[model samples]
Every structure is written in structure tokens, then in C-alpha cells.
Target: MNKDSLNTDYLWFLIIKSLIMKNVDLIFNEKQESTLFGYVMKETENKDKIWFWVTIAMTFFIMLLFALPTIIIDPYFHYHEPLTDYGYTFYRQRYSNDGIVRHFDYDAYIVGTSMTENFKASEASEIFGYNFIKVPYSGGYYKELDHLIKRSFSSDNDIKMVIRCLDYTLLARDKDAEHEEKDTLHPQFKAPEYMVNANPFDDIKYVLNKTILFNETYSTYLNIRNEVPTTNFDSYSNWCSAFTFGRETVLGEYTHTDDVQPEKEFTQDDYEMIKGNVEQNVIATINEHPDTTFYLFFSPYSICYWDTAHSNGTVKWNIEAERTAIELLLECPNAKLYSFTNDFDLTCNLDNYKDQVHYGEWVNSDILVRMKNGENMLTKENYKEYLDEIEEFYSNYDYSTFAVGNEEQ
Candidate 1:
């Protein structure tokens, strides 16, 4: 037990003692020494002592019972690899990605937000000839994704390639901006510090957490006891099948308004924010690992998104920020940048998207094939042309007349 547990036990003992001896006044003690009152007092005090010990014992037993699974099973694999006899699941990417990156055997990893979740490890392994792991942090910021990559490189294994998607919509935000809590009302879903850092002292939260203990640790143990199969690595975080994909489904979720959108000019602060985002989160990692090839691609958002940006008057600066990131990334010899913005047929069709930005699973597979074939690659010579073409196509497109027929689903 730690100091906190000891102090709690001591305080509990004192409270129990005080409650048991409250009536044993010193004024009558001398006269009632041999009386029935003294006998009752002695018996009552002895019983209280027994009860206190029992309470303390029960407290420790319960604490041990609650915390033992988290330590032994370790669903997150925080300390070590999964035990050979036990089955493990690879869901909960935010909680388990750190442990997976540190302990898993892989030479390459795909890192990004939910946009990269559908990319299969098996497909990458076949295409790249290196053991691949897909670690996606849905609704993640650049800092945490970069931290995960650094951890992977710092591990005992040698990382050869990093395939990641750079979401164009996230280009203009502050470098330190985190949507971990602001995205939802509940904040308990944020990443744990104990798992993120190497400090063992702060692990108390993780060890004693009800969510990790029950939802993860005990669930895994139950799965093993019941002889249930572990989750497949390829389909671990693939959520494409859970929802329908079509033009109606996509545009239904797409909210367009004629109300005046927030139109703020991109200031010097905006420039610095995006520059720091690219320099610190994206470029710094590439510069450090020249031997490891970084396959960076911009996730293709639907043209409706581009039109909304234009209506909001952010299309110009948004393009500038993404363009700036592309220029900076291309400067690194280890980095290979790809863009799908010029694929007007894909972006213009709402039937290809389940939402305004998220594409179907086929798109994920298609992206891999395209990258492997060197199609639509952004070189120093052609990147300018790609940018100008996308700018013109997006800025001049008539979104109202765009067809929404069932084409790609």
C-alpha cells in the first residue's frame, strides 16, 4: 500500500475508536471500575478493535481484488506483452496504441486520425514487404500522433516506413489544440498520462480505473476463460461496415447554411500556428529519421466541404496552409507526399462518401494502390500544378447542380 492508503486506514481507525469510546467518561471511571459499566466498556472497546481490524482487512482485500486484473492481464499492455495463454483484443486505439507501438513487432506503422483506420495491416505488408501495424487515433491532434511515432522509433524494433494521412481540414488549427474533450461532453475518454509517459507513479489512476479494469481487463480475462477468439488485426478498428454508405446518407449528414459563417483573416498568428504544426509535429519527425520513408497523403474531403470553406471565406487561407505543409514536407528527402484533390470525379460525387469527409473502405484500399503505383504523387515540379488545378476546380464548381446518384457504393 502507498502512503495515501496508510493514511486512510489510520484515519479510519481513529474515527472508529472515537465512536466506540464516546460514552466512557473519566468522571465515573474510578467508581465504576468494578461495576457493570466498566465491564461493558471493556467488552465494547475490545469489540470495536476487532471490527476496526476486520474493516481494514476487507478494505485491502477489495483493493487487491479490484487492482489485480489490471496489473496481471494489462489489456493495454502497459508494462509487458500479453501472456501467451491469454487472448487479447486490439480495440480502443487511443488507450492501447501506446502499448502496441512500444511492444508490438513491426517495421512500419500507419498513423493518423479516423481517416486512416480502414487501411489494413495485411494489405500494407503485402505492398511494402515490411511488417505493418495500423495505429489510428480518431479525432487526434498532430502532437499525440508524432509522439506515438517517436515512441515507435525509440523502441527496440527498427521502423522502415510510416504511412499517414494529413487531413486538410485540420491544417489551420493551433499546434497544441486538442479536441480530446471539446469534441464531446464527456471528458473521461481522454488519454491517460500514465500510459503516455514513462512515469510509474501516476499509474495509480490507470490501475484503479473502473473503465480500464472492467471494460478492458476483466473483459479480456472473460474472453480467455470462455475460449473466445481474439480480434483480427486487419479489421481491428475498421468501422466501415457499421453504417450505410450512399449519396443520401452522405448529404443527410451534410449541413449547409446561408447564415454568415465566421470570416476572419489569416493573421501572422495563423501563419505561425500552421507553421509550428507542420515543423514540430510533421517535419521534425521526418528530419530525425532520414532512413525511414514517410508516405504522407492528404485525405480527400468531398467538394461540399470545399464549397462550405469557400462560403465561409476560409478556402484561400485553408489552401495556403495545406500548400505550405506540402511544400515543407516535400523538402525532406525521406518524405513522399500524395494528393487526391485533383480527382474531381471522386470528390464531386457525394455517393462516394458516408459523410462530407470520410470515404468508404474501397477508397482506403484505392489510396494504397495509387500510392504504390506513384499515381498523383506531389513532386516539387507538379505540386504547384496540382494546387492550382484543385483551387480552380473547387472555387468554380456548382455544388447545387452536383448529381447524387448511387454510383460508387
Candidate 2:
């Protein structure tokens, strides 16, 4: 592929005929091969020159064979859309998410951390009157999600709405440095840069990758022959089927600590940090694409989670930060803000969740209906009252019953 070197196709011809020329009686019957062999061997006497051309020819041919499958199958959807007739497995989130974002067909998408994995794309699409895809990063940061969304807009898809969750705890993090692109919960997996950016020089990381070769390319071949399982693109990353939801299950996952985590109130500095985080990562995208409506919600962490934060002294701090975030979002005419973080029926009931933050598929279904029906939506007028109501609910909720030894807790 390097333009500076000898042209590869020309060399292959020289290579085969020159080998046969060693015994001339070994000819494989071809005018083309004979013609090319004459062009390279013509007026050439040095033995070293012929071998040099043969080696270069073999190198390029081997390289081409190794890279061809990745280019055609494109396991990551890096180069093209999934061949419509090809079946694929969509289990690896970090590896396939970028390709889905760029090449998958959709007018709307759900983007968030693990808190969002239960959302059913088909249900959301039906309610919103748009095709929806889910792009969830279990422990994703604002900067990373924003980068992926920006790529969506850069593509030719006519995006309609962007549904994203505003994680309350993340509102207080450092404006620019609090991301875990590599140091995530699953540190072994991280989205590679060659696929994320437009650079082609580093594309060797993708074109010759082993995962793409054995797992993706070979797996696709198996699918075509009905020898392997395939996934529906719509239900790609939904994990609601993997866990049961109930008070016992939710509490079983939590380990009660007596450390009496020190409490800190939200300060002016914290508000500034929240502002900087959104303005740069979220609002900038909203401002850039006014035609694309943004459905922004503060994901509801269960009451047990709030109680833990309350004991640690940061419940009110998170509430105020979320309120500030809502205020900023409401100013964007195309943005709709929902404050589900305080929905008592959902947040107070541990049966709706698998853990402190992740809710059941039914809860995700309920949220979609609420968003469709405009319930829990914050207006410039009622956000103050609604936020206060949630603050009091979470800040004072009883969490003793959620202690360890509780079933599924």
C-alpha cells in the first residue's frame, strides 16, 4: 500500500516466472506470467536483483492476504456497514460500540453508563417514532460518550433525538481529567484509538488484529454456515436478561460499611466544575446540532444508594448539582430534561433494581413510557419544587433495612 515502494502486482508476476525460470521446464502455461517475467529479467544479469524483487513480491502478497478478511468482514464496522446478509455476534461492547455508532442505521440512540443498559431500543423506538440504537458504556465518562456522539453527527445519519442519562455523582468530578478510558472496571478492554479517530497510519492495529481475525471474521463465517449463534442488533447490549430484580437481590450486592464517610456540602467551586463539565462535553454537542433533540434524564439510583450517600454527607451536594445541570439543559430549546433521580416509587422500591444504580428492564420500560407521557419532566417553572421534593425523600429515607444479609441486597 505504500506508494513509494515498487508496485506489488507487478512484482508477483516476476516472482513466479523467475522461480520457474530456475528449471524453465516447470512452466505453468501462461503468456501473462511469461511477459511479466521477461520485463523484470530483461537486460538484468545480477542474481541479487532478481531475488530482491521476489522477496518484495512475497511480502506484499502475504500482507494482503492477512489484511483482506478484516477489510471485507470489518468486525468492528470500522470500514463499512455490516454486510446486510452477514450475521454477527454483538456481545463485546467496547469493541463494537464505535462501529455501531458510526455505521448502524438509526435516527435516535440511547447513550449512558451501565445505568442505561436495561433500556429496550425497540420500545423506545416505538414511543419516540424513530429508530433507536443503544450505545452503553458500563463505566463510561462524559468525555468518552461525547466523543462517540460527535462521531455520530459527523456521519450521514439523519439523527433526530439523543437520549442520554446524567449521572448525579459524575456532576462533581474534575472538568477534564476524571475519565477512565483505560482504567475502567474491565481494564482488559478499551476502545482502540485507531477506530476512534480518523488516522489511517495506525490502522495496522485494526487490519491485522487477532480478535478481528479469529473471533470476528471466523465467527461470521460460522454464522453463514449456521454453526454459531448470532445476535439481534437492536438488543445488542441489553443486560436486563442476565440479572433478576428484587429487594433481596439489590441489597445482596451492597456491603454495609461503618466508616461513617465524611459528608461535604456542594460549594460554589463544585457548581463551576459541573458547569464546565457539561458545557464542554454535553452542551457543546447540543449547540452544534440544534436539529437533534436531546432527551436528558438524571438516572434514579435506588434509595439505598442515596442513603449511603446521605450518610457520607453528599446527598444534597449531588441533588444541587443535578438541579444545576437541569437548569443548563432547559435553556437549550431542543433539550428536554427529566429528573427521575427522585422518583420515589422507582427509587424507593428495591424490587425495581438489581443493584444501587442499575434498574430492571421493566423499570427501563416504565421510564420510556414516562418520558413518552412527559411524567417526571422538569420545566423551568417546577424544577425547584420537584428537586426539593426528591432531596427530602432521598436525604431522609430509611436505609437500615437494606443492610447486608438482606436477600439479593
Highest TM-score scorer? 2
lDDT of 2: 0.76
> Best-fitting candidate, measured by lDDT?
1
> What is candidate 1's CA lDDT for residue 377?
94
Give per-residue CA lDDT, model 1, range 1-409, as digits (tens).
6786566546544654564456334322524767544455565757566556655865665566567778988888887777777778767776788888888888998999989988888998898799998898887888878888888886888889999889877777778776563212126455566787878888888888866665567668767788967665579789888878767777677555544366557778877888899899889989999999999999999877886786787776777777788878889999999989789888877767888788887888889889999998999999888888887887667655433442223
Per-candidate clashes come to 0, 10
lDDT value, residue 47 of candidate 1: 58
Candidate 1, residue 120: how far the Cα is off, in Å: 0.9
Candidate 1 accuracy as TM-score: 0.80
lDDT string, candidate 2, 1-409, tens digits: 3652234334433654465456442222223335545555554677477767766876775566667877898877887778866777776666777888888888999998887887888899889899998988777778778888998887779999999988876776666754556623247865566778878889888887755665567667668888554565446777778888887776677765545566686788988988988888899999999999998888888887887787787877777788778888888999988877756777878878888888877877888899889998999899999988887877666666665554443
lDDT comparing candidate 1 with the true structure: 0.78
TM-scores of all predicted structures: 0.80, 0.85
Model 1 misplacement above 4 A: 1-65, 182-189, 257-266, 402-409
